[model samples]
Target: MKIGILTSGGDCPGLNAIIRGVCKPAIQHYGMEVWGIQSGFRGLVDDNVVPLEEKVLSGLLNSAGTVLGTSRDMPFKRRFSASSEDKPSMMMKTIKKHGFDCIVCIGGNGTQDTAYQLSKLGVNVVTIPKTIDNDVEGTDVCYGFDSAVSIATDAIDRLHSTASAHQRVMVIEVMGHNAGWIALYSGMAGGGDIILIPELGYNIHNVGSKIIERLKQGKPYSIVVVAEGIKTMENKKAAQFIAEEIEYETGFETRETVLGYIQRGGIPTAYDRNLATRMGGFAAQLIEGKQYGQMVSLNGSTIMPVPLEKIAGKARLVNEDNDLIIQGKRMGICFG
Candidate 1:
């Protein structure tokens, strides 16, 4: 069987590992030819492909980005270029001409939705969930979550020393889109004074009070962590607003650090590499089993396939009532 794999959506840390994982098993054990689709579906539309021999897959286990490259371009959204085609008919024609027995999609929620739409057009597709957000539904965890959380947590840890020495309020912004996993985990792990996630909208006055209370307790420094997607009444960014509010409320020097793309880059953590490896191999296994229109997912300790319909148009947001939040509350961590 000739299998095609593509990485879509925002770039993540474990993409190359997934490519290596799939190519290794599919080529050696299953005797399947692997073809890489470049730049997600846009590449597919343009017939851009590269053969994935075993040699190309080597030394990529520890790599961070996708060798096949990636883009956020979608078939339904003509956002990439003026010449972009939004129709799947062209995609179907390209798939038929290439004779891809099966195709694997490595991406997050939007990518999965596109995969489902392609499957409906009679394309044989399997998906692997990958995002730093860890918000894809029907999976316990995604591959890139560990690596991103580690980076964000490390940033927070380093910020603590500087904030202490300078006696300032440091507002660190981490990426989460709409979920609070990154903010919550990094905050808990790095001992943040306050955390703000999109799941729970925060009151500026309450946050100011907390900073003032910390100051009253003789704590000169404070560390506040927030998700990039967190919003205020006018959908403004939280970092600058929080910093200004805390400074006015406590009369302390406030600084904002946005860990933008740095969290998305760098080497994949061991956990992400292992997870991507398992997911990729499992995707190959599914293709070998003739399982189409499914997504390879992790349920507890087992790797398995889930129906595409279940994952499309759905996201797994952090549960406000989960144990993590409860523990954070118990530990006196502010989740504003």
Candidate 2:
């Protein structure tokens, strides 16, 4: 049978590994012809593709980013629209013209949404969750999360020395885009004094007071880990704003470091590499069963198939009552 594959939305560390996993088993064992869809959904609409072979999957298990390439999921706008409703129909035509029995879509929430849309349009899609946010529901963890957390935590740890030596409030911004897993894990591991998440909006006044309290307690310096997804109660959050706020409120010098793109460009963490490999292997198993509209997910320690429909509707969030929140409280980390 012929199959099409694509990775969509924000790039992740385990993407290449996933491609290797899927193509290895599908091509070697299932004897299926796999076509790599270039540049994600745009490729689907534009009909850009190439055949994928076992050789193409070689040595990709340890690589970061996707070999199939990727694109954002914004159905409202195609890269270049020829006409209204023409794009979606054209996307459908690509699937038919290529004579693919099914498609494997590896990506995050936005990508899943795109897959669902395609499914509704009569193209069979089997999704694989891929996001560092770890916010995609139905999966205990998604690919690339470990690498991101590791990168953020390492940055936070390294900043401690400089922040302490200079007696400054170091506001470290890490990627989340919509979730707090990166900031939460880094703040906890790196011993950040303040951690901000999008789910729980903060009152900057309280955060300001915490910094002042730290000063009074003889801790002249503070480390603040902020997720890019979060918003302060006043609804103002640009990295520069956080730096200025420290100076304005506590009268202490502050520095800002936005860890944008840095967390995304490193080697895959050991955990991510293993997870990606396994997820890819598991993806092959599902395709073997001829399951459609399903996604491979890691639930606790087991690999499971969940309907792509449910996984697309809601995002998994950090449970407020979870152990991490408790640990943060014991460390006296402000959630503001």
Candidate 3:
């Protein structure tokens, strides 16, 4: 059988490793041909593809990003929902015309949703979940989460020394378009004095009081971890909230550092390397077993192939009652 693969959404670590996993099993075991589409769906739309072989998949098990390259140029573009029904049909036609017997897509929610639609159009598809945000549905852990949280945590850890020397309020901002997993986990791991997430909106009184208490406790320096998407009690964006909070509250010099795209690049963590490899090989196994339209997801410690529908329109947000949030609050970490 012939197979095709593509990566979509924002660039992430471990994407190339997943491709290696898929092509490894397909070629070594099933004698299948795999081709990679360049620049995501647009690659197919524009008929740009490169043949993938065992040799081509070599030495990328721990590499980051997609060798096939990627882009956000979806058939639906930013509409997300409006382009699904019709654009997916066109995508399937493009796949079939390219002579692919099956397709494996490795990406986050948007990519999986498109994979499901294309499968319904009679294209056999397998998906591997990959998101640094860890917000995709049905997966306890996604491939890039480990590396992202590691980078974020380490960034905060490094900031501690500088904050101490400068004796300033260092507000380190990490990526999280809507969720706070990165910020929360990094906060705990990096010994943040304040942890702010989108999940918990706090009043100025709450944030200011915590900073005041920390100052009273004689800690000259404070490390505050903030998710980029966090919101205020009044429901404004966290970046905006930070600006307002900085203007309204006073005591120490405030500085904000956005980790930005640095968190998405770099070598994959050992955990992500292994997870992507397992998920990739397992994805090829599923395709051979005739499991179409499924996404390989890690359920705690086990990898389970879930029907794409199970993840369609599904979002796994950080638990509102998670111990991290509750414990952070109790320990006097401000979430504003």
Specify the poorest-scoring 10-residue window by lDDT in model 1.
78-87
Stretches of candidate 2 exceeding 4 Å from the true structure: 76-81, 232-237
Clashes of each: 0, 0, 0
Most accurate candidate by lDDT: 1
In order, the Cα lDDT scores of the candidates are 0.89, 0.84, 0.82
TM-score of 2: 0.94
Give the poorly placed runs of model 1, Cα more than 4 Å off. 79-86, 233-236
Q: What lDDT tens digits, residue by residue, belong to model 2 across residues 106-216? A: 988888877887788777788888888888999999988889899889999999999999999999999886788989998888999989887777877778999999999
TM-score, every prediction: 0.96, 0.94, 0.92
Q: What is the lDDT of candidate 1?
A: 0.89
Give the CA lDDT, 0 to 100, for residue 155 in model 2: 92
Among all windows of ten consecutive residues in candidate 2, which has the lowest summed lDDT?
73-82
Error of 3 at 81 (Å): 18
Q: How far is each candidate from the true structure, as Cα RMSD in Å? A: 1.8, 2.0, 3.0
Q: What local lDDT does model 3 show for residue 307?
A: 87
Compare candidates 1 and 3 on lDDT and give the better one.
1
